[model samples]
Every structure is written in structure tokens, then in C-alpha cells.
Target: MELTSGIRDFALTPDELSGFHARGYYGPFKVYEVDEMRRAWRGERLRLMDREYAVYRSEAAESGNTNIANYDRHLDSAYLADHITQRRITDRVTSVLGPDVLCWRTEFFPKYPGDEGTDWHQADTFANASGTPQILWPDGAEEFGGTITVWTAFTEANEETGCLQFIPGTHQSMFYDETKRMHYDPSSINRKEKDGVRRGFFGYDYRQLQKDPDWTPDESQAVSMVMRPGEAVMFWSTLMHASLPHAGNVPEARMGFAARYVPTSVRVYPDTEEIEEYGGRVSLERHGSVLVSGEEKYSHNRLVDRTTRGHRFVSN
Candidate 1:
């Protein structure tokens, strides 16, 4: 794939890097002009619905469930494939994850009018719902391993539209055990309230995985991330994060596309053949991690050089 020197831009400065380490998050950075993002989304959204080249082509994936159906569209949509490898996103990610980084996964999070907010939670192994370790790090590495998630706003994200909420510095510790089990009940969705807020973890209760049943996230420490269309934020996957419920004051739904990144040393979906979660299942037969930056020193994960439609991924 041809690459441009522009990919070298957007690296986090020293101060920004230190702040990210201290706060576990950074930026409502601008990735695209608002009109540019809106225009792109308008066209891409229509193209994405086709899904002929998507890796997870299954009945369950198209069943209207929010989970599997909204995953890895980058593998099919050229626009989304380019979005994931955008220098604005990958440069900042590599700033934190070192030179060699891989775009392991991507998912679309949409909050419709009156839909319940995402329950506050942190993920390490990412097995909270699937009961399978999604990412594994080698021994002698950090005590905990988590991917860097870059969440870009495709639509306006405001207080009424259910913007993301984060508790600073919470990435250093685990409040919920990923190994713990969380029951999935689709009927429970948008039907429960937690600490007086309407929230649910997709179809599961994230509270079920709490290390301490009585423990609660300190709302006093939480901050809302209000973003404009084309804005993006990067945070550690283990950061205590959630969102507010859409108040239905707006006509449009809030859409955030999250691209997950990890160093080449980390294994993506180690020993997994299929993903069964959120009451949906998809095979990994066509799965491949996109090396977004630097070299791939590890062979533990499958790598794809192009989108299923033959769009080349931008990489050095």
C-alpha cells in the first residue's frame, strides 16, 4: 500500500503523552472537518449496509442485535478500512503503544433515542461477556494488558445524545473481573436502572462482573466527553468508562466508531475460532489483524494487508 508522510503527523507531544499516562485518556482531537466527516458517513453508511465482503456474514450478525452485527465493518467497507488506518488515529495510538501496533478490532456503538446508556465497566482480557480471553499478553509483561481504544464520533455526542463518561486514572486497576460471568438477557436491555441511572452493558449487566458487589464507581470522579462530529478520543480499554442514556431530545442517534489497537507483541483472540457473545455468534475464519504502523515482530495473530474488497491498509 502506498503511504504518505502525513501519517507521521499527529504524534502526541511529551506533555500530551504524560497527561495520557496520568489520566488514562486523551483528546477530543479533530480527525476530520465536521462537514467532511458528515459527508463521508452519509456515503459510507449506505455502502456498509451491503456487507457482502464482511468477515462476519451470518444470520445472527444481521439480526438487528447491536453487538456482533456492528463489528469490524472496516474489514468490508473501504471507507471504514481507511478510517481505522487514518494517520490521525494510528499516530496517536502508536505514540502510546510504541512503534509497532496492530489494529486488532473495531466496533460501532450506536445510542438511539431513549436507549439506555452503556454501564460503567473496564476490560482487560475482554472476556467479560464472551467467556473467552480475546487478547493475551506474554508473561513478564505488565501486570495487566489492555488495548488502546480510539472512539470517533460519527454524529454529535452531547449530554442529551449520550456522550461517553470516564473516570480518570482508573485504567491502572481493574474494578470488574473479566473472568467473572455476566448473564445475557435481551429482555433486560433498557429495562433496568443502576444507581438511579438507566444503563445496561449491551444485553448484559456489567455490574455482575464487579470485583466487589457493593463497590460502585465514584460518579464524583467521572467526566463526560462531549464531542462534535469528526472528533475522537483515545483511552485505555481498562479505563472505567460508560455513557449517558439518550434523553430523546434530539432527532438523530449518537454514533461512535471504536477502533482497538495493541502492540504487535499482544495476541489478538488467542486460540479462538468463533465469537459467541451478546446472543450472537460469528466465525473467525476470515479474521485478520491490520498492522497499522511499524513492523510485525510477532506471528501469533493473523494479519491482513487489505480489506476484503481489496482496499490496501495504510502502514509503514
Candidate 2:
């Protein structure tokens, strides 16, 4: 869909871009016409039950009950895909990354009420098929090779419900070596106090870096991103961010969708023919379709694909 002529005039201002460049992330950007986007999200949620049920059964059968995974539950659904590619979203992404952008992948993160929060980590830590390291755009212009991550809030996100957080200005640096970092431990809860040190997700366990004489900042300071429904936050993939645990007793689970976009000029992994997130070696290009806008083409990835069926959950 084409954006309205006035849409280009709605792009972020220089001051706003500067804030993102200095802070590493920005927004609660007033993107979608709030009411309309909210309605669209609710419609998508109403259809989620059938999708969830089908996924549960399929996943259980494929991996056995012990190893079941729900990552692909939303793929192929028209409702969800439309929301991800909505014109309001694509325009903002194009403004940041320039005309040529490809969506590499999209994923839904449903943090159940009372569920533990995700580990603090940089998005770049997980490499896409494109082996290139994620870039940071301090200047918010095309010259920096910047990528845009648009995270849409499907449900109300706040501190009580495990909203996302980030360390301002942390994305400007290169990725920390994972070899020296700690592996993720799902069973044991991370109870470390934020001591003002700038660390990304799983930075705590990486002992060698922790012991570095130069690494003296406390690791406890992070800015949480609490947003209302229909509000979206955009961040560079290299930004150091993580979500807090859900402390609310809300009957419904917290749901959010993330879409990753990069310029088309970036080379995707060549070995993989098709993108498979579950268990196959797939390339980045295969994961998402390319979004061509004017002179630019952006890569579009689906974080959540809709399913044919839905599931119903009894509120506890």
C-alpha cells in the first residue's frame, strides 16, 4: 500500500533523530493512527486462539511434548501479516534506513503474566543469515548503514507486565564477544542487581569481561520501555536491551510483535535456500520479503505469522 503524500512530511524531526542517535533508541513513536491500529491489533488477538491451538498440537507432535516450540505459530496468517506490513510502519522504517529495506524476520513475544523476564542482550548477538554485524546510526542518516527495528505493542505494556528496557547510548559500540560471555540458563533466575554497569543480555555470566580491570561501571542501570497499545518503539539492533519480569495479575498474557528491517544492499547468507527458524539453517534474505519504496528497497521479516486456526484460553 502506498503512504499518503503527507506521510513523508510526518517523518521524525532532526531533534528526534538526534535523540535516538545519542540514546540508542527512541519512541513510543506516534505511528499508526492509534485507534485504527488498536482495532487491528484486537482483531488479530481475537484470532490468536485458533492459531495457538493448532501450533501447540503441531509443535508437540513434531518435537515430542518435552521439546515443543511455538516460534512458528503465527506464520502465513493474513491478519497478522497485514499488521506487520501496514503502511504506517513501513514508511517510518524507510525514513530511517532509506528506500532499500528488507524485512529479515518477525517474532511474537508472549510473556505470560508472572513469567520471568528475558535476559538482557543485544539483538545482534543472534546473527541473521546475513553474517554482517549489526550497525548503529548515531547520526540517523543513510551514511551510517543503519537498520530499524519496529516493535509494536499488541497489548498494553508497562512495568508491571515486564516491559522492555535498554541502556541509552550502548548501541554505538561493537558487539561484545560471546565467547567471553555467559551462556543462558533458563532454570536459574538471574538475581543480579543493576550496579550501573553497561551490560547487554547475558553479560553477567561472561566472567572474563566482568573481571576486566577496565570494566568498572555498575551493571544495574537500564531504561524500561513502557508503551500503550498501538504505540511502537524503534531501536537499532545493536542496542543493549532486555525486558523486566511481569508482575501483574492480568488475566491475559502480554503480547508484542517485532519486525526487523535492513537495507537491500546488505548481503544475506547465500547458503540457505529458504528461511526456517525452527530447526533449519536459513539465510536472512529467505526469512523476509523485500519492501520497495520509491528509490529504496527494504528487507521485511515476519516476527509473527498468522495460522489458519486459533486457540481459546480460559482466564484464570
Candidate 3:
């Protein structure tokens, strides 16, 4: 079903487009009304607990703490399937990624009260955790290689609730090498501090992938993104970004749904059958990229139109 009555376009203006290129990120723009988002989330949250159609079906896929469990709920849930193709998101995403785009992956980022902030990091091949390039761009695509991430705030995201932070213009160069290995220790979560801020990268230390072990992120240059429910931000995955620790001042958890997009020409999870991360491993048996915009002319990656539940995905 269509999200609304008429055609809605949320494409970025020329100035906004240029600003994103300059800063490596764009807007906490409106995607849904506050009350609408809250209501939708209330039902969707319960529905998500029944993940019978989810792509990953390993033992760890049922664990609340493992990141693998949160991967690609869009592939199963009707609400999320519509969200990825929502014009509010896809219009702006295509403004940056061009006409033909594929939503390769999506993941949920939740921070409960007293939860540690995410470590400052950037993803190029997204191999920081798994030690394998998840997405491989074409040989001549060196000018831009990382995926465009559209992170939607499902709940209040503020300083107290661990909102995201970004260092402007840092997407052009990667300070961390995805080829380097990172050790995963779930116990290390919320147990360490970087520059006096409580932080960790899920179960691994993102610093382990840093090209310069001696170099540290300059916190002074970072800016926090405070957003209300239903707002969304788009940025290059290679941008230097992280979140603050939830201070426990508020009872509500900060929930972020991140949908990752790349041009159809790029190979999604090249030659990978399974992903091992966050202390768990899962098969990619049912994984396929959703073409969110335009026609797919490439056959290098798998593509799916309808979700596992027979709900057709909205494509523009």
C-alpha cells in the first residue's frame, strides 16, 4: 500500500545537497509525525519480537544483546519495508546516491538508560567488526565507496538518551583500515572509557581498526545530533560518527533504525555466505538487497521485491 494519498517529494535542494557534500551529512528531517511514529512503533515493537521471517536464524539471532539479531528487520516487517522506500528518505538518498540505489542492509541501534556510547568510528567496507568487506564498489568507484546511511529516530534521541555525534567532512578519508582485525569481547561493553566518555563499538573496540594506533579522535570537533521522534538523518557511512552514553536521566530508550543504501552497481556482501559479529554468526541464506529507487541493471547482487511475508516492498 502507498504510504499516503499523493506523490510526495523530499529531495534536497541544491544548497542542501551541496551542504551535505561539504559536511558529509544531512538533516534531522521529518519522516513521520511524532504521534504517528510513537503509535506505529508501539505496535511494531511487539510485532518485531515475532521474527519468524527474519533472514538470520542462528541462536545468537534470538539474543537481545547480539547485534546480529537486529539486522534487517525490514526484510520481515511490513512497516520497515515501507520505511526504506518512503519518499522522504529515498528522495533525499537518491539526491546523494544518484537515481539507481539499493538498500543493502538495515540495523537497529538502541541505547537504554546507562548504556555506553558508541565508539567514534567510520565504516568503508564495513569490515571493522567482521574483518571482511561487506560491500565492494567497482574498480573506478574510488571517488565514493561507502554506503549512505539513513538513521531514523524511533524514540527521543538527545544528549541524555545517547544521540549521535559527527565530525564534519571526515567522510572523504578513512582513518581506520577495515582490513585490520578487531577483537570482540561483549564484557567490554560499558566497561571502558575513551577520552573520559564511556564508549564501545557493540562488542569490539573500534580503535583496533584505526590506521594510526597512536592517534585519537579529537572530541573537541565533534557535534551532537539531537532529534525528536520520527526525524531522520542521512550521512556517508565513512563519516566519523558515534553516540553519547545514555545518562540515565531519562527513562525512555533511544532507538535508531539505520537503513544502508548503495548504488545498484556495487556488490552487496561480495562472496559472503554468513556474517560473524557481535559474538554471533548467522547465515545469509535469505539475504537480498531491496532496490529502493530506479531499475537495477546489475546482476552482481541478489535482489528481492516482496518481503518474506508476501508484502511487496515499495520501490520508486
Candidate 4:
């Protein structure tokens, strides 16, 4: 499949949709030319430093774990705000999630040279890290409750640079239970291993919450998502996925921007006001999920029409 100008011509064909449901993931589809993505990041990185309108509290934004600190820029940055609504990303996301969708979260996954690979895991309520049910689907939709994640590579992602890897068709059943508790120790960041691989879940070991301590994810079916800058992959948040350790000798880091989408029927951050996790805490006073497509008929969550910079969030 060839790349098209986003929004103008980028809906998935029937076969593409079928493949996505069967495999639980789809694409290293092109969103921007390698050079185009590289150029955009060069300038945007500087503007991102000013996060005055960022939704998270100062403590959360300054957490020792960079992933937590880099959460949800789409709520503040114009570039990211526009990004979550892109046709190439949103159209496909809506296809899986249905027309009325809300982008409840965005995160930056950055892996520096020699950093530990992400532990193989999946998320349902996203309570794995925070120990709080962040999203709740209605009873009828409970069977498929996880969010749809569109992860875009903002930099080169390869085996050596800690690219993503996935075990196909594993979205149907979960190996780990989010309700189980996992101790968060910031010192454990780069100092853990599972099944012999040097990996850790930011500050927690994912295996702590495994449904069966004796059961481990089979790594034999893993496929590396080596992508050029600007390419993206869409997957169920419950899919068995992990990443390689950044072993490259280069100083450049791998950056994957992930925007999470869910249907309007789902309640985001249900009965939660503060996110306490990863050895830190953040208040959600300023947090608001953006409507990326269709319309919102529910009043369960706060909605934002513009970014902190006064940039409008255009809904498709």
C-alpha cells in the first residue's frame, strides 16, 4: 500500500481492517517522509519545552521516569493536538473503535542508548502502573475494553534503537492482570531482567502482575517494528508487545509518540482525581480528553476544544 496525503485519501480497505482484527495490529504505514519527520522534530522539540498548558501537574511532568514526565503533550502542544486527529491515524482508529472516539491520552516513549528494553506486557484499564482504573468501558463492551493505540515513530526505530516488537493475535486474551499490584521502585529502571532479557516496565517489573507466575509470554513469535521516522503502527493496547534494548552505538534516542483512542461510551479516569504511580503523583485538575472524531453524546469526562496555545482541536 502506498502512502497518501493524510485525511484526503487514507481509509483502510476491507482486507486491511480484516487483517487488523486478526493480527491485533497493523502497519508501519507511512505518515511523513523520513526527512519530513526529522525536520519537524528538530523544531518542535524546542517548542515543547514550554509546557505551561500541559495537563499534568508539575511533579508528574518532572518525574524521574521520563515516560511519565512526557505524558500527554497533545493536550498542550498544537503539533500533537493536530497529530491525534490526522486522517491516516484517526480514520483507521475510528474504524476499530467506532465513529465517536476520544483521544484520552498521549505519551512519549523514549529509549536512549543502552537503555533496558520495555518488558513484554499489555494494558486493559491502564491500572498496571497507577493502580487505578483509568478507563472503563460500558458493560456491553467489556469484552474489548482496552484502548486502541496509534504509536508513531518520531525518530528511527530499529533493533539497535529499541524498536517495538509484537506477538501477533495475542490481543484476545490477557496474560497479565492490571488489578494485581506491582511495587514501583525508581531505582529498578535499568536494573531488572525477565526470562534472561534486560527489561523493566519503567519503574515496575510487569511480571509481578502476571496471571500465572509460572507462565511467561512466548517470545518466539515476536516481530520487530523497525520503522523510519514518521511511520506508525496501530494496535490494541491488550496486544502482547515489547521493545528491544537500544544497543546502537549512536547518541540519538528512539522516540515513539502514542495517542490512545476509545469510544465515547467509555468513561475516562473513572472516579479518579489524582494519578499516583511510578513513585510519583499527579493531579488531573487540568486534564481533558480531546474528541478526535464524530461526536460526544456522553457527559462522563471533561472535553477540550483547544490546546494551551489557543490552537483549535479540529474534530473529524
TM-score of each: 0.95, 0.68, 0.95, 0.93
Candidate 1's C-alpha runs over 4 A off are 1-7, 310-316
In order, candidate lDDTs are: 0.88, 0.54, 0.88, 0.84
Over 228-252, each residue of candidate 1 has an lDDT whose tens digit, in order, gives: 9999999999999999999999889
lDDT of 3 by residue, 206-280 (tens): 888888889987788999999989999999999999999999998888999999999888988999999988888
Cα deviation of 291 in candidate 2 (Å)?
A: 1.4
Ranking by lDDT: 3, 1, 4, 2
lDDT of 2 by residue, 99-152 (tens): 655564566777777666665555443432223333333334433543567887
> Local error of candidate 1 at 113, Å?
0.6
Give the least accurate 10-residue stretch of model 1, judged by summed lDDT.
307-316
Q: Candidate 4: lDDT over CA atoms?
A: 0.84
| Pairs in clash, predicted candidate 1 | none
Clashing pairs in 3: none
